[model samples]
Target chain A: MNLHGTPLSIVIFALFVAAVLFLSFFFARKAKSAAGYYAAGGQIHWAVNGISFAGDYLSAASFLGICGMIATLGYDGFLYSIGYLAGWVVALFVVAEPMKRMGKFTFTDALDAKFDSRGIKLAAAISTLVVSICYLIPQMNGAGSLVEPLLGLPHWVGVILVGAIVIVIVSAAGMTSTTYVQFLKGGLLLIFSTILVGFVLSRGLSTEPVGLESGAPRGEMTVQATDSQLLEQGYALLHTTGSLQKYVRDGTTTWWKREADGTLWRAQWTSDGVVNGVAGGVLEPVGRLRQIGGMSEAEAAAGTGSVGPLDFLAHLTHPETRIEQWQKQAVTDEKGAKYAVYTPKMVSGTDQMKPGVKFKVHTTTEKLNFVSLMMALFFGTAALPHILIRYYTVPSPACARKSTIVAIASIGFFYVLTLFMGLGAAVNGTVNPADNNMSAPLLAMSFGGVLFAIISAIAFATVLGTVAGLIVAASGAVAHDLMDRFGRMDLSDRQKVRAGKIAAFAVGIVAIVLGIVFRGVNVSFLVGWAFAVAASANLPAILMLLFWPRTTAAGIVASIIVGIVSSLGIILTGPEMFAGPYGLTAEQAWHPLGQPGIISIPLSFLALIVVSLVTKNRRVAVEA
Target chain B: MLHGPARSSGPDPASGYKTRLGVVMFIIYCVVYAGFVMTNVVNEGRAMQTIVFAGLNLAVVYGFGLIIFALVLALIYNHLCTRKERELNVTRSEKGAGA
Candidate 1:
């Protein structure tokens, strides 16, 4: 759906960008030293650092993608929220303290803190670069999408705008500026989402929702007509396959499903406002209730006046409540021209609240894929390069632990709100079936235009905060690990900060290009792959280094290399990638698993052990 | 030439206690999380649809439970570790000052 840029949204977006730039410039003076640039001088209070973690982690994917997924697929999206928040458990329990005590600047520093080997530095730095770049693609893409509705600009313009703004943020002050921006964004996101959920609760559930009446306009004309009558009104029969017939008139396509009695029922896009032979208004905006608590149609029209949080979920999940769900089907005409058409089906509230709708886990491969995704999400948190680097921004191991706890409390609360916001959008007739990404924004618009503007601006800030964090991680990899440590350049602190700034600019440009190039791909899928890569590559190395005393420099290097190669190899050849950019059938792909974590994670651990044993014996022989 | 300068050489006094506590908490979470994934996988979410508690199905109840549980565990873990660090490290520091 094409979204128009309102004057209010533009003003809010401009103010948000202006504040971010102002923060960047303000902090520039303090970031002249390498330590200050990379880690905010390791003096950020635990509370601010904690919320910044949430800001950095809750990328566009968490807000837009999860809300969109939940808005459409129900419980499946919350599965992501659960997995994502669970990953922090690993971060707090396993990686947080050790990473803080050991590392000085970047993720590589923590890994090489013990062995200090050039090989570990090089391997870890390269992995950080690769992972950061992969993660950057989705954030950049989300920025572009947001810009279209906010500023009425093209996607590339949005990509370039975010890129330029983030480059300035990273180069000007680095972590200091990045932290404050994230803290602000994280705080606003939580506050406004709570307010929006309040609006949802106040408005409550309604069977006969006002705005888009059952996705069809109210009191519109309708008449049952024969096939002859439909054709007489200039509806061309596009194709007839099985019980479904496709038709087109004036570039508007519609579907007709034949009933058992041989009568045809039509479902078409409502915006076209085409009604001939079919009803004039039956194809309305969807996502309203058919019935609540077994009420009659007349009684249900009264709607639930207002509900508390628990009451909303209880009523929505009642078995007697029927929700209008829109399912999209890919249809092809006689000419083989293909497009998607939405058809409405009534689903029980209980069924919508369950898991089977999105992920069909009956097949063994599908079940394994589901489990693999959860594993990646569970282990992926502590291993993420950006998240790992956040540890160094705190003063001590104790502070790291405390900050992680703060992050968990705030993020968990916000995730619970996602369920309400998503269901609110689902039942309020606000979800745009064509692009579920617009669900949250549209839901906000349902409350009022001002709330919509603030939410959009916050969503835009969400993108900026995450992208800046990624760039900071990527640049630290280049300047600190690769250039200074691995290459042994021995640069001064001033020169090191300058190198990082330059690297930030270079990485930002690359992110912008990739974002525009991969515009139409699913943002969540890319993010999932990033997590898988992080879990497979970084987790094993970090874990073994901290816990395993015999872990050698060679082992860490070997594990990092194996982790990066295996995960990337699997993902590039996996089913999703094959079905997507490669333009091939999913079954034709080499890999069976959609996620690489289950296999690659273990492979990395094994590589570390085997390499360490062999290297240990070799060192003994050399000494003799 | 293979080794770079290490930041700190001696083992930390609180390291042993903290690692043990962290590992235990990590294992507990992993087991609970695995159960959630397995429940959906085994019966094709049939178990998830069954109303488990509070008039909510097993899916809604368990999914929200996992999120809230993680935070609670985190808070508990942080509190315990902080207490241990104070108890263990303060004694070591006092001994060091005497030496």
Candidate 2:
């Protein structure tokens, strides 16, 4: 879909960017020291930090990517919601309180707290930089996606726009501005989503409006519509699958789509077509929710008038209801020319809600990939460099605990809301084939343009909040951990801040380039790789340092190095990087599973234990 | 009442209980979540997606249940740990005064 910027949405976007810059400058006045710059001088209130935690944690991936996934793929998208919330269980139980009690400036500070080894510092700092940059790329990608639709700017401009804004935001006030920005983004996302869900429930479900009819034969069934009628309908007619071209055909309003073989298929008002060699009544998109399964013809006609939350999910589970599902297929035309087509299929509501729809787990490789993604998400939250650094912004160990709990509550609530929002997008008929990231904002457009503009602005802010945190962690790795601690720079406080700012700018530019390079890949999918890398590299060292009594400094360094190298090795050769971004076929990729966590996580732990045991005698000898 | 801040290391009795409670909660979470994965693998998502409510499947409900379960378990841990810390501190103060 070629999305033109509405004036309201562009203005809202400009105002949001201006507000974020103002916040950076406002917070910059107080960030005079290393503590103030890196950790907000450890003065953040637990409540504020808690919301900020939600802010930092819920990136474009969570808001846009997950919603888009759910909208397009049914229940599979909600799996991320579960896996993401589960990670905080690790953070709260194994990480948060202990992290505050130990570390001062950075995540590396915590990793090297006990050994004070230069090797540990160097390894941890490098892993932090790697994880932060990987995480930064997705946020930038999401930004680029948003800029095209909201401001009508190109994707690269949006990527650069977010990159420049975030560099200034992080380099100016560091954690202080980042935290506040996250707080704002988190709060608004929840509030607006709740409102959107409210609209979904109240409006209930309906098919094509009064102008459209049922059982009008299986050819072209387009109805003449004035611009006022389209506005009255709220959103443009959206199809779940292939692009719908609305025009007159044989004196009737028609929705036509061209096949790869120079043939045009028309979707009539009567849902009848032979899809995938199966003859069935197809679910046509008329910018309204179709009647669900288990609903009697009359009851469905009544449209579940103003349902409660339970009623919404209950209605979706009915076997009788039909859902529009988009399936991607590569087909060769008569000339042997290949094109990727996203064809919409009318799926049983019960089947759409089932597992096989999105994650076809019957295949062994798919099962392993699914489990690997879950593993990464489960362990990754505590290990993420940005998330770990947020723990230090609060004052006491207990505050860290309380904030973790508060964050769990806030984040958990937002995730629950994501299910409804995703479903709302699915039913509201705005799952653009070109950009899944715009689903939530497009769903907002179904309500009104004003709401659409606000949601788009908030979604952009979501990227800003997350990217700023990533830059802070990356810069800290360069300036504090690498330069001052391991590089033996002997830098003053002023010099450290300068080094950090420079690192932030350099990293921001790299992020912009990568974001442009990988434009249409789902942000959440990229974050999955980031999590796998973070868990594999960082979690093993953190857990062992805190738990194993015999953890040697050499063991820690060796394990982190092993974890980082192995995961990156696997990821670079993996299917997603090779076939997805690199334009190679799946069989051409060196590795099968996209996520490395199921392999690399245990490998790191094993490396730590073996290396620690081997160096046990050395530790005793040194003590003597 | 605002319970006092958590103790910062140096061998307080409360740290042991906190660690124990944390381990137990983590283990429970691990088992339940792993069980979720195994069920999906073994049954291949059929058992989980079976409709349990009016038009709501077990998969959706169970996923939601896991999220709420984590929060409730966290609350229980916080409560138990805070109470143990308070009790141990009271006992320590009494011994100190006598000595």
Candidate 1 has which clashing residue pairs, if any? A215-A284, A215-A285, A215-A286, A216-A284, A216-A285
DockQ metric, candidate 2: 0.35
Off by over 4 Å in 1: A210-238, A248-253, A257-285, A618-624, B1-12, B93-99
Q: Model 2: which residue pairs collide?
A: A222-A253, A222-A254, A292-A321, A293-A320, A293-A321, A294-A320
Which candidate number would show the highest DockQ if scored against the true structure?
1
TM-score, each model?
0.92, 0.87
lDDT of candidate 1 over A546-595, digit per residue (tens): 77767788888899999999988888889988887788989999978788
lDDT of 2: 0.77
Weakest 10 consecutive residues of candidate 2 chain A by summed lDDT: A211-220
* Candidate 2: residue A566 Cα off by (Å): 2.1
Predicted candidate 2 versus true structure: per-residue lDDT over A1-624, tens digit per residue: 224678998898888888888988999976777778888878899899998999899999999988888887778888889999999999998888777766877888877776678888899998998888788888898888788878888889999999989988998898889888888888888888889888778767644322122221111222334434543655343232344444432333334354455344443332124332235433333223456666666666666677788888877777777766655555433345343444455667777676666666787888887788789999999899999998888887767888899899999999998888888777766666545667788777767778888999999999999999898999889888888889888888778778878888888888888988877664455677789888998999988888888888888888898898888888889887777768887788886877788899999999988998998875422110
